[model samples]
Target: MSKQPLAPSVADLAPDDSILTPYDYEHLGTYLNLLTADAEVTDWREVSRVVLRIDPAQDPQRAWQAYSSHLARAMWMSKLGHRHLLGDIPSLH
Candidate 1:
């Protein structure tokens, strides 16, 4: 049987967003995990398997690249990407 579709997360922002990829809809948790791991200065290989579910033992290069790219995007979200998250801002009365 197929898995149930997940509901969209609040972190899945698109307001003024242009750099989003298909992974953005599904991997918000992974992004947060990477952000937290970055704060902790954790190992990427371990995070790749544990958070990204891409085991380096299976495909080392793909796993490494996936982890690196996602981590960078996660950092981007923690920085400039969040500015676009609201999509549109309403005037505060």
Candidate 2:
């Protein structure tokens, strides 16, 4: 069976504004560029869009959790060669 895609809630989709202060946007831009450098790589288009929409007042913990969730999903896809089993975001360290 094909796995379902993750449909985050509006609140979960919101980006954390605090990231702007603690990190350089240019650095993120670089990372994003690197992630999309190879044409063979399936770019995280939706993840990038949602991350760019983070609210400045969003909680740091929540923002971190969301990022980590994205990373975890990507890792799972890489290992399994299949989409993730969409569900609740897992807690990360």
Candidate 3:
């Protein structure tokens, strides 16, 4: 089985009102992880190392930014992105 390729990281992002980037599509799994971690109130330091691949000891700001951004994305996915998937699948013909 083939897996989806990862998305390229961007220099800046926020908890915006839209999900229109390839980053958004590619990081769905990461977002899910972040969402789960957030719901469980996991530590950001660990979430950073595991999910965002950042070392909080080396750089705290970027790590936090990545975690929070993806957490917001996870919320967006749960609230809105799923709506897009509801009817997007097509039967192979």
Candidate 4:
């Protein structure tokens, strides 16, 4: 079996496209992690440090922007962006 692709490096802001982009595909794991963290009510600073690799202590604003934007993108992926993925499958029709 082929290995799963590793998540790409976290961006300062996730793409805000109406549909998922190649970057979104690469960051699927990251999005899931962010969603999990949100569900668990994890602290933003900690999530930023661990998942996003942004040091909230050194740059609070940047870290927050990155974390929030990424988390929002994650939510979008679950709510709407996933539909776009279905188009990738070869239809029997």
Ranking by TM-score: 4, 3, 1, 2
TM-score of each: 0.68, 0.33, 0.73, 0.85
The 10 consecutive residues of candidate 3 with the worst lDDT sum are: 6-15
- Report clash pairs, candidate 1: 15-87
Residue-level lDDT tens digits of model 2 in 1-93: 553223323233223332222122223342343234323453344343454333334555555554444454333343441322234233322
Write down the RMSD of candidate 4 (Cα, Å).
4.4
TM-score of 4: 0.85
- The best candidate by lDDT is 4
Give candidate 4's error at residue 21 in angstroms.
0.6
lDDT of 4 at 31: 92
Q: Model 3, 1-93: lDDT tens per residue? A: 555556334333544656445556566677888888888999999988887778889988888887777787778888987676666543322
- List, in order, the clash count of every candidate structure: 1, 4, 0, 0
- Off by more than 4 A, model 1: 1-18, 88-93
Alpha-carbon RMSD to native, per candidate: 7.5, 13.3, 4.0, 4.4
**Collision pairs in model 2:** 15-54, 15-55, 17-55, 17-56
| Number of the top-ranking candidate, with TM-score as the measure | 4
